[model samples]
Target: MREEYRGEKGTTTTGFDLGRVMWVRKEPSHDGLIVPKAEYEQEREEYKGWIAKEIELRGVPGQLHFKFVRDTMRMNTDGVLMVVDSSDYAMIGDASAILAETIASFGNIPMEVIANKQDRNDAASPQEVASWLGVESATGTCAKDHESAKNALIRLLKKLE
Candidate 1:
């Protein structure tokens, strides 16, 4: 079980009781095992148990469950609490406005947006989208461009770090 990496990435409103998500960076110690602090350990264990139960409920294969957990853990540690959606996306009529409200509710952290296929007669801009969302407009990026996405993510992470 020790070798089994169980964790997840990204934010979710699902009833995944992680107790509390924490940011932990390994200290520059010469020790072999980088054991997490006692408090973080407890939270991690709780998160693991919750994830396992959810997987069981969904009747997913062990391998897939393992992947989900790993992704979640990664997100919990390294992912920023940001939502990505498009203005045209139906879930939120105006994705930017909805995102802004969500960010406000969650408390401010470095947020970024990748406006996919934004409508513009040369008037649509990243600033316009960011302004609508009430976030400091990040450089708008194209989802099809991998480098652009990476840059956007890096930009946000650096701010958080």
Candidate 2:
């Protein structure tokens, strides 16, 4: 899902599906109701109110210039999965800054922080990273390891539910 890698230190291999872990399709608005565009448009008079059936987690690209896309996503985002490179000590500052900004922008939303590259010898512990970022906890993950990545996303999805 990610367009580019952050080139974190101690990274062994970046999985092709690193950030594409979850994607729930939008509600079938065409199932005799209205249309999928309803989410971005005014409700039909026939339906008194909007009932959001589910949240679709789209991967917002990490590029700096894609701010506009992320802004658009803020309107519909129900939860966030922020993956950080645990071994990248140099980039931790940037990560924490972005994390704080993201939390503010999506106030009160469920956010899961993944301390990735946990397989790296120099990687910081997930608990340490979480504490540094001021989050209660973080999931340790080696994205290249399928099970680790799957488990992290599964736990976050559960919290979102």
Candidate 3:
């Protein structure tokens, strides 16, 4: 998220911001099928693992103009990556309510919860965050580290596959 490969490092996003990046991963193999071209029916390069050639990462803000965006931003939404502050214990309730509202609005779709700011002294573990948010699993990540942030996306893509 710090602009090492894609997206400019900036302040909090209050609206839809797009980030296009080709993320290639080999480990934690993808167990999904890739549609091949008609002429090359047997070729399966697209499904070798997680290879997202292009992805539009958007920030559907939680507080700023949220109701407007939430009501109309469901077109082609592949999945949602929910990031919560691991250090801020009080916001879990609000986050849970928002999460419930998201599901109530979007139906059953692919989603991933991330407990970010792992570097903080008072940060919660991913498991703790998950339990607090009533989710099965939540990936641990810190925004400053490129690999950490990328792993969060990778995990979400893996779920999509």
Candidate 4:
């Protein structure tokens, strides 16, 4: 998180870039545990397209690689920085626990979450998210908003430091 840029305002610090993953919500059918088959299939195809696009943007070679466990999707990473956004779903099996477990499973790498449109919800706050993810710290940000996201990036970088 060291300052990597200089300007009239002085030094600017940047955060690491974590790979991105989009989580989609599945609609349930008659069975509470099961999502409607057609709806689920539609979402599946959409996400697959998204993953392919991300790999292309990254310019990765060979076929794109990924998997899902406990409703969370993972990218095949070989020790590279990754940033995961869970804005696609409202709540994924306890955000805090899921994030903690994900990071742990990913070898304790510095990970971040952007609570997209989080301000819309009266109940969920960044601090609440931090507490839930079992992370001592986290930033609440809207990815669509550049200014807010930039500030969040700074915080994430500082955490790395």
Best by TM-score: 3
Query: Candidate 2 residues 67-144, lDDT tens each?
Result: 688788788666788888899888778787778778778888888899999999999999999988999999999967
Candidate 3 residue lDDT tens string, 8-106: 557753433235444444444642222213312244465464543446676776753486886677678888998899999988888888889889877
lDDT of each: 0.43, 0.69, 0.73, 0.43
Clashing pairs in 1: 7-69, 7-73, 8-71, 8-72, 8-73, 9-71, 9-72, 9-75
Clashing pairs in 4: 18-82, 18-83, 19-82, 19-83, 96-132, 96-133
| lDDT tens digits, residue span 35-95, model 4 | 2334445566654433121211131211122223322434654222223233434454444
Residue 129, model 2, lDDT: 92
lDDT, residue 105, model 3: 76
Question: What are the RMSDs of all candidates, in order?
Answer: 14.8, 10.8, 8.1, 20.3
Query: What TM-score number comes out for model 1?
Result: 0.40
Off by over 4 Å in 3: 1-18, 25-52
Clashes of each: 8, 0, 0, 6
What is residue 150's positional error in candidate 2, in angstroms? 1.3
lDDT digits (tens) for residues 1-161 of candidate 1: 36754673445344543333232323322111212244555666544422111111111112322545533443333334333344443533445444544354445545556554433344346676566556666465654465665556545545655
Model 2 segments beyond 4 Å from truth?
1-55, 63-65
Give the winner by lDDT: 3 or 4.
Answer: 3
Of 1 and 3, which scores higher on TM-score?
3
Evaluated at residue 69, the lDDT of candidate 2 is 82
Better of 1 and 2 by TM-score: 2
Provide the lowest-lDDT 10-residue window in model 3: 31-40
